[model samples]
Target: MLKNLEPYLEKTIFNSRWILAPFYLGLILGIVLLFIKFIQKTIMMFNTVFSASVSDVIVNILVLVDLSLVASLLLIIIFSGYEIFVSKIDTGDHVDRPSWMGKVDFSGLKLKVIGAIVAISAIDLLKSFMDIPNELSNGEADKLMWKVIIHMTFVVSGLLFAIMDKVVGDTKKH
Candidate 1:
C-alpha cells in the first residue's frame, strides 16, 4: 500500500508547477493594464498637441516610450520565466512568432532587462534636463542633481552586468 502511494505522491508533486500558472496569468493582466495606460497617454497627447509646450509634448512622448519598454520587459520575463521554471510553451504552427522567444537564456534576459533600464534612465535624465530652466527657477538644483546621480547608477549597473556576463561567457568557452 505504501509503495502504491509513493508514485501517486510523486506525480502530484511533479505536477505542482501549475501553481505558478496564476502568477503568469496575473502578469498578463498587468500587461493589459500597461496597454490601456499607453493608449490613454496617446489620447491625451493628441488632445494637447496644439496647446502643450514643446517640451511637455516631448516629455509625454517619452513617458509613452517608457511604458512600452516596461511592457516589453515584462513580456520577456513572463515568457522566459514560464518556459525556464514551469512548463514548455507549445506554440506549434504559430507564425509571427518572436525571434527571441525561446532563445533568451537567463543571462540574456538579464542583459536585456538592464539595457532597457538604462534606456529608461537616459530618457528620464533627458526629460529632467529639458526642464532645467524651470528647475533652476524653482530652486530644484539639488533634486536635479539627484536624478542625474540615480541615472548614472543605472548606467554603471548595466555595465557591470554586461562585464560579468562577458567574463562568464568567456570562461565557459575553455
Candidate 2:
C-alpha cells in the first residue's frame, strides 16, 4: 500500500507546478500597464519639446529609458522565470524568438535582475542630480543623501551577487 501511495504523491506534487501559471499571466498585464505609461510620457514629451530646455529634454528621455528598461526586465523575468519554474516555452523554429530565451537559468536571471536594478537606480540618481536646486533645505538635502546611499547599496549588492555566483561556478567546475 505504501509503495502504491508513493507514486501517486510524487505525481501530485509534480503537477502542482501549474499553480504558478497565473503569476506569469499577471506579469504580462504589468507589461501592458508599462506600455500605457510609456505612451503617455511620450505624448507629454512631444507636447513640451519646443518649450523644454535641454536638461528637461534629457530628463524626459531618461524617464523613457527607465521605463523601457523596466518593461524589458519584466519580459526577461516572465520568460526566464516561467521556463525555469513552470514550463518551457514552445517556440518551435520561430525566427523572432529571442536567442537568450531558453538559455538564462535562475542564476542568470538573478544577475540580470540586479544589473537592471543597479542601472535603474543609477538613472534615478542622475535625474535627481540634474534637478538639484542651488540651495537645498534640510529635508531636500536629506532626501538627496538617502537616494545616493540607496544607489550605492544597490551597486554593492550587485557586485556581491556577481562575486558569489562566480565563487559557486568555480566550485562547481572544481
Candidate 3:
C-alpha cells in the first residue's frame, strides 16, 4: 500500500501542471478582447481623421501601436509559458508555426517580457507628451513629469535585465 501510494502521488503531482492550462486559455480570451478593442479604435480613428487634431491623431496611432505590443506580449507569454511549464507544442513541421514558439527558454521569455514592457511604456509616454494641452497647468505639469520619470525607470530596468541575462548566459559557457 505504501509503494502504491508513492507512485500515485508522484503521478498526481506531475499531472497538476494541467491546472495551468485554464490560465493560458484565459490569456487567449484576453487577446480576443484586445483584438475587438483594436478594431473599434481603428474604426474610430478612420471616422474622426479629418476632424481630429494632429496631436490627437498621433496619440490614437500610438494607442494602436501600444496594443500591438501588448498583443505580442500575450503571444509570447502563452506560447513560452505553455511549452516551458507544461508541454512542448507539437506543430510537426507546419510551415506556419512560429519560429520561436517552442524555442524560447524561461530566461529568454523573461527578457522578452521586459523588452515588450519597455516598448509599451515608451509608447504611452509619447502619447502622454503629445496629449499635453497647450495651456499647461501646474497639476498637469506634475503629472507629465511623473510619466516621464516612470518611463525612464522602465527603460533602465529593461536594459539591466538584458545585461544580466547576457552575463549569465556567457558564464554558463565558461
Candidate 4:
C-alpha cells in the first residue's frame, strides 16, 4: 500500500543529499587548477620584476591578487556549500582549521560570495585602468567604459544582496 511505503520513500529522499558530494569534489579540483596557475604567474612576475615598469609590476601584482581572491572564493564556497547542503566537515580540533569553517550559514555564504565577486571586479577594473595607453583608441575606450559599467553593476548588486539579507533577518526577529 502507499502508506506502507512512506518511510522507505522518506529515507530514500534523505539519502539523496549524497548526490552533491561529487560537486564538492569537483570544486576541490578547481582549487588545484587555480594553484597551478598561481605558481605560473608567480614565476612570470619574478622574471619581469627586474625590468618591468612600476605600472607593469602593479598590473602583474593585481593579476596575482585576482587569482588569489578567486581561489579563496572557491574555498569559501566549497567549505560552506558542503556544510550547508551536503554534510559537516569533521575537522576535529585541528590547530590550522579556519575559524569560519563551521560557523557560516547559507545567508552568510551568500554575502561572502557577493563580497568576493565585487572585490574581484574592482581588481579587474583597476588593472584595466592601469593598462590604458595615453592615446585612447575608440575601441579600447568603449571596452574600458563597458568594464566600468560591469564593475558598477557588481558593486550595486552586492549592496542590494546585503540589504535584502538584513531585511529578511530583521523580519525573522519580529
The candidate maximizing TM-score is 2
Q: Write the per-residue lDDT of candidate 2 for residues 12-113, one digit (tens) a residue.
A: 998898899899899999999989999999999999999999999999999999999999998999999999988999999899999998999999999999
- Candidate 3 lDDT over 1-174, as tens digits, reads 898799899999999999999999999999999999999999999999999999899999999999889998999999999999898899899999998887799889998998898889889888887877879999999998998898889889888988988888789664
User: What's the alpha carbon RMSD for model 4?
Assistant: 1.4
Alpha-carbon runs more than 4 Å astray in model 4: none
Estimate the TM-score of every prediction: 0.84, 0.95, 0.91, 0.94
Ranking by lDDT: 2, 4, 3, 1
C-alpha RMSD of each candidate structure in angstroms? 3.0, 1.4, 1.9, 1.4
Tell me the whole-model lDDT of each prediction, alpha carbons only.
Answer: 0.86, 0.94, 0.91, 0.93
lDDT of 4 by residue, 1-174 (tens): 999999999999988988998998898899899889989989998998999999999998999899999999999999999989888999899999999998999989999999999999999999999999989999999999999999999989989999998889889664
Error of 3 at 21 (Å): 0.6
lDDT for 122 (candidate 2): 93
Model 4 clash number? 0
Better of 2 and 4 by TM-score: 2
Error of 3 at 35 (Å): 0.9
Q: RMSD, model 3, all Cα superposed?
A: 1.9
lDDT of 1 by residue, 69-155 (tens): 888888888998888768878887589777777788889888888888888888888888877773274458888888889889988
Worst ten in a row by lDDT for model 1:
130-139
**Whose lDDT is higher: candidate 1's or candidate 4's?**
4
